[model samples]
Target: MAGLELLSEQGFRLDGRRAGELRQLRARMGVFAQADGSAYLEQGNTKALAVVYGPHEVRGSRGKAGAAAGALVNCQYSLATFSTGERKRRPHGDRQGQELSLHLKQTFEAAILTQLYPRSQIDIYVQILQADGGNYCASVNAATLAVIDAGIPMRDYVCACSAGFIEDTPLADLNYVEETAGGPQLALALLPKSDQIALLEMNARLHEDHLERILQAASKACKDVHALLDQVVREHLQEVTALLGK
Candidate 1:
């Protein structure tokens, strides 16, 4: 708030986005030929790649392969050593990476129709090639697109977004500067059609009175993300169809 103005008097954010406005989103599916499914996405300055594999036999010990009643879901989240302004010592294997990986697994487990592939395993790996803000949110959205490209069954499309509350206004899709402002922020992942929440996380506490408004703002942002992702999927399908005819 001191070094940078998060919200100007005109209601524009540091990046010139209005309250509840998301950043520019560009995405493509099937970016990789070998993986079962792959996607690359850019949300403002943040870029991520997601690759999905398996829905086949488990790789490790059967005891750790999970229950036969449902498929095992595994996720790994990594940030490139140079993804941020400061270089990282390791791409992963750290405490933050481990936590994000667990969050991703839980989010996918709630969305993917795991029962159909009982005793099998599905692996999703998300890497942050560039970091702005909303790293977790971008990862979720990209992973969802990758899963769709892989032809995996799911209850609905999963979408995610991050929101920050300041000056009694909710700012959607915060950038690195806004995120570092030390304000109350919320991250959400949702199955838009069913309005089911796959994950919800909050950092810094907001007044209870403003919680609902922040949630609603984040939910709307997720729907906006879903629309963009759906369009990308449609375009990818059309291209695939055209290639098949050739």
Candidate 2:
């Protein structure tokens, strides 16, 4: 909100992206052999790693003693000590982290076919390696890839993206600089194939009339991400099949 303008008059963002353009996306699946599944993803400058375990019996006192209906999903979200440039950082389990964890759990609950694993549980852990912005969106996307790596049945790929309205233009895939400018920010989690919404959250204030346009921009970005995820999953599966056949 200071000297830098969130959106330049030329319709370019601080990172040299068009108003509706997304940051460069780089991702890989099956990054951890020790876990049931894992993935690492980078969306712009924000990076995250996700690991999944279980779909076995639920664990700990928090879980029910006996098998219940549907699978339980537990998620832990953390920001690595050095994820942010600031030395004074919030540790794991901080209020923001906990809230984000719950958001992730809710997102997956809608996308995963939990009913198929009745009485079981799936644990997802995601750590933010870097935080330029869109942290939750990156984490959700990473978790979806990790879940897919575990060969879990899911209703659809859960793709997420963030958008903001600045300078009378809608911006997709916000970075830290735009985020701190304090415009009306919208975060969306989508089941792209079904055109269903898993989660949609907005912060700050925005006009009702402008909401639909911003949402449309975010949805388009999510669909684009879904296509990328599909490619990654297909490639990973092919490689695994080839190795297994050899």
Candidate 3:
């Protein structure tokens, strides 16, 4: 909130974006031929790759294997050593990485129809190749695309975005600078089709009066993400169809 002006007099943010505007989003599915499903996505400067596998017998401890209830959703989130300006000694196993992994698991559990694969497991692995703000949101979006590419059953697409409050304006899709500005920021994931929220997290303190505006901004951004992901899925399908000579 101090070093750089988050919003200008003209209502533009540091990146020349409107308060509710999201950064450029681009994604592609089936990025890896060997994986059951894979996707690469870029949200502004944050880049992530997600790979999904399983719906097979659980790996590792049989005791931890899911019972007759539903498929066990396992998520692993990691950041590349060089992803941030300061390189990390290890990519994962840190407290932050573990926390992110749990968040991912919870988010997907709400969207995926895990009940379809009892006694099996579904694994989602996401790696951040670049460190920008909204890494969690980008990871959620990328993982959703990978899951779809895997042909997994899901109630609906899960889309996510981050929002921040600055100068009485709710900013959608925050960047690294905005995140580090010491303002209240929220990360939200939604099942757009059903208008259901999959995950919501907030950092810092925000006034109750501003919560609604921030939530609305984040919801709108998530819907926009859903549209882009849907288009990518359609294009991928068309390409596959053409390749099959259908």
Better by TM-score, candidate 2 or 1: 1
RMSD values, in order shown: 1.2, 1.4, 1.3
Candidate 2 TM-score versus the reference: 0.96
Q: Candidate 1 — which pairs collide?
A: none
In angstroms, give how far residue 105 of model 1 lies from its true place. Answer: 0.5
Per residue, candidate 1 scores C-alpha lDDT tens digits across 1-246 of 576777899998877889989999999999999999999999999999999998888887863546488889989999998899896488346889999999999999999999998888999999999999999999999999999999999999999999989888988888898898888999999999989999999998789999999999999999999999999999999999999999
Query: What Cα-based lDDT does every candidate model obtain?
Result: 0.93, 0.92, 0.92
Q: How much is 174 displaced in model 2, in angstroms? A: 0.3
Who wins the TM-score comparison? 1
Worst 10 residues of 1 by lDDT: 58-67
* Order by TM-score, highest first: 1, 3, 2
Using all chains and alpha carbons, the TM-scores for the candidates as numbered come to 0.97, 0.96, 0.97
User: Which residue pairs clash within candidate 2?
Assistant: none
